[model samples]
Target: MSDDKDVVIKEYTAPAGGWGSMKGMSKILPKEGISPDVLDALRRQNKPEGVMCVSCAWGKPAKPHIAEFCENGAKATAWELTSHRVTPEFFQKHSVSELAEWPDYDLEQAGRLTHPMKYDAATDKYVAVGWQEAFDAIGAKLKTCDPTKVVLYASGRASLETSFMYSLMARMWGQQNLPDSSNMCHETTSVGMKSAIGSPVATIQLEDYDKCDAIFVFGQNVGTNAPRMLHTLQECRERGVEIVTFNPLRERGWERFASPQSPVQMTVGAPTKISSQYHQVCAGGDISAMLGICKYVIEADDRAQTEGGERILDHHFIAQHTVRFDDFATFCRNARWEEIVDESGLSRNAIEGAARVYMKAERVIAVYGMGITQHRYGIDSLYMILNMLFLRGNIGREGAGPGPVRGHSNVQGQRTVGITEKTELAPVERLKELFEFEPPTEKGWDTVESCREIIAGTAQGFVQLGGNFLRATPEHAAMKEGWAKLPIAVHIATKLNKSHLYPGEESYILPCLGRMEQDMQTGGRQAVSMEDSFSHIYGSVGKATPAAETLLSEPAIIAGIAKALLPDNPNVPWDEWVGDYGLVRTAIENVYPDKFANFNERLFVPGGFWKGNPASHREWQTDSGKAEFNVPRALNASGFAEKEGRFRLVTLRSNDQFNTTIYGYDDRFRGIKGTRMVVMMNRADIAHLGIADGDTVALESDAEDGIERVVEGLRVVEYNIPEGCLGGYYPELNYLIPLEHHALESHVPAGKSVPVRVRI
Candidate 1:
């Protein structure tokens, strides 16, 4: 392993996707042992016998190309279907303490878990155990604990059927304490968008991008995170659609991109320019930047009317489909230009230019990601974007709407399947009537609250369907200590992660099948469903053989535990549901009669069915019976006032990684290699600090919390980042962000912005 201090940074001169992506894939695919059969499986994505790409939540095109997967999607598939195994002999050779010394990448490279294991503290080793024994142990511990003290965590990778069964297990156990990955990623989209547009999901379809006259992307890196979306952007660019972007990094995706799938472009080395205009907004300044754009639009509308030009504001749409327009307009107009310029880190001209592009287009689509949501005022930022769209009647119309692109495959679907901490009354009543179990109706803890509850000793055990909970969450030290002191922790996973290594007093690691693997039950092969970002419910069937024969399907594992926990009660048919997933779909349809009436039948179609959203068709389900504009109150400060030498650090993902999974030790697009622990700082900031580009530095958060939050020995790299703002890889710098420093209403961790002091 190369030293992080000896990192390499090059001038990334190539276009986003063209040859670079293809070359990287060529290197990794063969290394991961992805054969021609896997390529055939990937080509059949979104088909009847194919699984959804286990990557970002970018919706698949209505009529997808023959090769439907993107570079990142292919990497994700290869990462999961790697021809490697962690058998009982491997575990026997390495103790838990020995494995703990290995890096996360090495741990992942150790390969898939082939058997259920129990952590033996005496030997500090994990020993293989029978699936029945693992389930029995978990059930025994669950039976002893108060249901409220049990925290049920779900990851985005879990299928809808699996999530449904897990939700039932939590509810049947007399609790609603189900905190999931969505709480950490896109909860702001749910809470804020529901308040504004009456729906928590994206209103636009995947085909809408083709029809959209203008597209605005904020905070998200489309090239790295959702690479497939770049193909749509390239097409939009060809059609002369205006693309505006606001992000701290002037990402290569926003500049130009050459699609590898395009033979002509790949051959000539010519690329389609994506963003028509790009602005580097400072960290934590998304709200201010959005306000600036809205203000410009409001001013331009007034000017057009005064000068006897064409009407800019949509009066008809405003009167019929929206409310409180006057109040929203007043706030935008009253916003100070100086404050907007200072906070946004963009000049007045740039903001106005973006506004002009927006005003010129009749149809507009606005998309955002965690960078906009993972902030103290994230909900407010979402409202600001909606307010801008409402001003021009962009939403609830053809080719125009808000698109809060969620992270993780089927994350939105997991939420739709009732994997929530707070249980609604109607769902509780339906569960009681259908399954013959009285579900607890009281609200439960979210991700942050669950962590706090565990630390406070209110929670005694934890059970997760997937995800690296300890590394993904904030306050790593606290979570580690809390887990170490817990009475029980159970993980249903495919690979070895940090969560499994650091166990409680009694920990059980249950190995499960991956998405690419076939799940055979008593009946036959089972197909599961997933909902994409656009609310499209579709069936996904795994084609690859199981990585290990001993691995059980996620639904089967959950059913096993359920059977053990509720053996005496004969009301629920766990065995039947696991045998055939159709039974699970039937139950789901019964729970959501209107949304999913003929769920199984719809799977036969090409694109599947659209779970109709009222807001998508201009029907408002809000309290006002219309879309409401919000007037965010003025804030005295955007965040904690750091000292003169301190910087606002924003943690982000690299090109080589997805969430916490590291595919390689390089951020190829950003010209970074062989190191993940590096901070990106402005050249001028580096000069002012009297530090060189390769100098190693330490970062300590400016927090009053008694817990010490510091990350040491991170090399610094000079880049085009905003002054007084720094960028680093996530799950690493997540240390500097305290658990309490999260979005106000949504409680999503403020990973995008943290007050930190950089030291030599």
Candidate 2:
């Protein structure tokens, strides 16, 4: 875009829906109510006007026609149907230099692209190109470079079939460099779950929550991040199940929920109370909290043994299925209570109280999100959760286990279908057996490595299935420069985004069909399968018409590119597979037979199919075939400690926000309406900083790896957050994330921890 920065623009924020108003509105309007703007835009486009149907990858499915759409989905839909248009003429009028001055939202809100375009650096303008020409150009570029030099990046929004075919095509071309969104969010779940159990997925089904005596939630914000989960948490609360929440901030969703499904609850303006006990644990202190709970559970068992002959753990199951009991016990004994209490920011008594709830409950479910996953010692934290669950034999049972609430609709499914950069030998052998092509044995680059490769000039081309990669990634300037250095960049997306603007020497934007849109092919109306957070594979039939006639299905686009690139071969049925997605699923079934059994037949079921994860039932797949207890060392003293008066800044999603997209800036639960500039800090911290509730300040963090980012003019809002922890909305503050701050094992950016000083 523009060489100079400092472009001034007006800011806009949308209004909020009140709890009472929202309750009343949920009745008259469908769960996913159609916005007036959305309806008007559809009518203008000569399409049917109505509420959109939404089924998140999570277990919750909204009603048909009036399905529940999250705030992010609303924003996504609105973004797709924007009144603005960026035709070839618009591109010709403004050079890339001028367009670069515009804010990300302004550039994207300009509207849906009507035709395939290529960036011409000579004129600094994008020129419309025919599909054939674009494909030919891509094929020519691929022919020049080694397959290993090309990195294929998949987003969470990509369908399982598309991801599978994309991965297959890459393998057929002999490249293992398939970096995906998983590297950013739930890689820990994949690595941790697979290490703990043979399969890497949550074992508990949606209905299993009904059988749970108690539910423990950590780090995840059920309302803002995964709103559909609020209903299940509410149901458990109504059924008298104890809900314990361990998070640094008291998220609104964890406090109370108003279910639109229940008529009486909606009419009476009653909210379903959630979280019987809310513990404000320090950020990156989850391991300490979990260890404390385990310590108390062990002490209770010891006391029971002394008094009579009762055991807290499932002794029979542990003895039969596990190894390494004495070693684990020794580690637990060596863990000091003082360290746990200090690190967790909670009293030993509070942890004991929480442990009592865990001990008394026969069936317990612990669910966590990015909060626990986005830390330097995140994997250790995750292992601790598994260890605690295993101690009481809480896995793979009817209602007890560890549930990692994954973001995106089909992120989990993408992994199931083999979108991983690090593919195992078994999958590689299976692929060779099925497709008659030897899959790459080398491990591919992850998100971080991909960037490094691109910057180092080793990576020649980049292709994204979806997602705003530049903004979402750490080290924005470096990432942007690396993208610019690439010879070609191809993006398959539904709407315009910041990533689309960061063009390479020759960039192409291939508009694709959205999940809500119909995909009519030669056979019939095609349906895509998505795996929810719980590992349930279900069919998603698109209802709305395509945003543009030129837009293609993601699979079709990939297949077309592959056809153009690869030499014609009998083994590669590229065209046949594109015509029908079943071929892709069949290949996926061959690769991951343990999980995707009869993938085509099972997807037709109304409620979908569940992938089995044996570890949840105490079937440890570790080296010892038992859950391993990892003793964590104290977190390195934070850099914030060196900065005398600064508080550790933790980025959070607003109730109205999702990821980097701001639907409308209204977080009703936080009493934040029509604004995203607010920062949530503990009252004590605010007082200590000599700042009142409504005072404006600049947030500055220590430069990491010699890179700096300063977010200024943030309005301070006092809330029930832990001391030394400050919360601000993501993406707006994503710049504050230092390039060096990332999880040790997962390589996920530490968005939860940024030492910052607030200046009035």
Candidate 3:
């Protein structure tokens, strides 16, 4: 066991997924004490008729190697199928009050939740209770509140089958507040992309890697977030697809990659160089940088027209398939160069260099992640990306379109199956026609609104399917107060988290089977389905047995509560659907015939089925019936990045963590070890702030709400980040972000480019 100071600030120059990939497995796998058949469990993930990797939303390869999973994927598998268990006896040894004080690492490291446990106020600890007894009490409390007062929240861990059932239950219960993990992450992709092209889903496929001339990735770290993507990237680079990365951090993953699956490369051969070019743009500078590129391309076209030069913009596609082209072009042309350079933290030469790469390629695929989404101007940022792609007619092509890699495996599918706060989705009317229930027509609360309602005592109860809502959201201290005031709360989970400690008056932590475990229901056996980031539907059946005898499947637990709440759910056959997950898929197909027509039929296919994006066919679902162009309002989207000389903050994830789950202390890529309380700053900024490397400090938010929010005891480490920028790991640093500091359109928290000042 080493201390925080044991590993100083050091740069890891190895490519992201080589020998460094094995560090996590070698360190944490033995601690998990998993069964000897763990290799079988690993082999089953992301395969044909196998379990989906809980690590990320990266698509599965149709013809994958023997080891299809990545290092992070393997860590997630080992954590899920660990032999350690937090049985009833374990709970008896620790009180709820005492356990609430534990760090997130310790809470998850407690291992699998084994049985239905309820908090006993008398003893200040949890006691095992019967499933029926717990469900009955929860239903009674829920019945006391109106639909508008109750929240049905879900994380991304559940299957689409379970999500479909959960969505049905929320509607059947007359509760339209259907919020899921998407609200905090990719919701911008939904709102912005649809506004630009009339479709929220990506028009990308795994095979597109072969035909794409160039790949432009913005604001996403592929190596740590989705290591399995390296195989695709390596192959694409090998075939001459130019890879361009725009990020604030000079990540090693994009520099080069040595796949663990390749024998010769892992031992003797040189690794594949992933990125042909890498640009370390300042945080929140994507919009300005994007504007610069669009400005250059449009100007080049103007020059080509006057001087008889090579072609630049695709004028034919713009005329045939889009509207508002002139407005977008005028906005780009009117933009000044000095403002673009200043806001983008890049010089004229670098911005022009990136534009050259874009102009050289005939077909390009542009992908972005949370870096562009979790901000005040998240939607605007995404719209700019579309505006750039639209100039070249990237949509409706063989090797080109927009790709948004989601953090959760099936978050997009959850929204597709009707888990949303929006009242007017494509399938919303279909649900009413089939179920004969009038779902609330008014828009419901998102994550931000729900927290506001819960905290203000306007909301009465909360039913979470599978997420760490408290830790995942901003304003952690206030959320704790809201969790205490709820009269009824129910969490269907596979393990313990901090959110579980603050139990409601009648709260129950219901244990459920994980994705790695077989789900044996009354109908015999079940296989669940999840949608990848690219709209590909996959069937994930568990290989290992359940951790405990009392644990039930997610569908079963959701059905039980649905029955208790609506004793006579006449329109829905809860028993039938829960018994057989295939029936849930049938219902999904019934509600969404166009998207998932063959439901179960195409689920088990070798690579699964892709629900086609209509935007890919040059068809629009918007009012204009054509791909639309949207212009950014300003270069500095956040409006606070240049205010008061505050440092721009960007939240980061380590190689050992996924979402909020911390696997180990070491982040092999960024050179972090034995600590999560770190704030990586530029050496010049450290000098300016009168601080040195390894100095302890606190960060205070510059939000206008007049609230004092800070995270103390963060170690400062000098890195290659932009001078006025800072980077820190989140859930630990999540406290400093004010809840109100989120996207105005999509409401995703502005976790990426928050204005903060270091407190000495």
Candidate 3 residue pairs in clash (backbone atoms < 3 Å): none
User: In candidate 3, which residue ranges exceed 4 Å CA deviation?
Assistant: 1-8
Q: In model 2, what is the error at residue 526, expressed in angstroms?
A: 1.1
Candidate 1 per-residue C-alpha lDDT over 1-760 given as tens digits, one digit per residue, 9 for 90 to 100: 4324466788689999889989878867886798765786688765544678888877766577878887888888888888889988898999988887677778887788899999999988899999888888888888899988888999998988999989988888888888888899899899898888899889998888878999988889888888888888899999999999999888998899998888998897589999999899988777777788888877887998999888788989999999999988888889999988888888999988988898889999999998888987888878888988998899987899998887888889888988998665238878888888788888888899998987776788999898988889988877877877789989998888888888778998899888877889898988888888898887888878888889999999999998888655576788899999999999999988988888889874666678988998989888999999998753311356647887888898888888988887878888998898899999999999999998999999877677678899898888889998999998888888899999899899988888888878
lDDT of each: 0.85, 0.72, 0.86
Per-prediction TM-score:
0.98, 0.90, 0.98
* Clash number by candidate, in order: 0, 5, 0
Per-residue lDDT value at 296 in model 1:
83
Could you report the Cα RMSD, in angstroms, for every candidate shown?
Answer: 1.6, 4.9, 1.4
Worst 10 residues of 2 by lDDT: 7-16
Question: Residue by residue across 619-670, what tens digits does model 3's lDDT show?
Answer: 8887788888888876755657476558889999988799889887888889
Q: Report the alpha-carbon TM-score of model 3 versus the true structure.
A: 0.98
Clashing pairs in 2: 57-532, 395-616, 395-617, 396-616, 396-617
Residue 715 of model 3 has an lDDT of 93
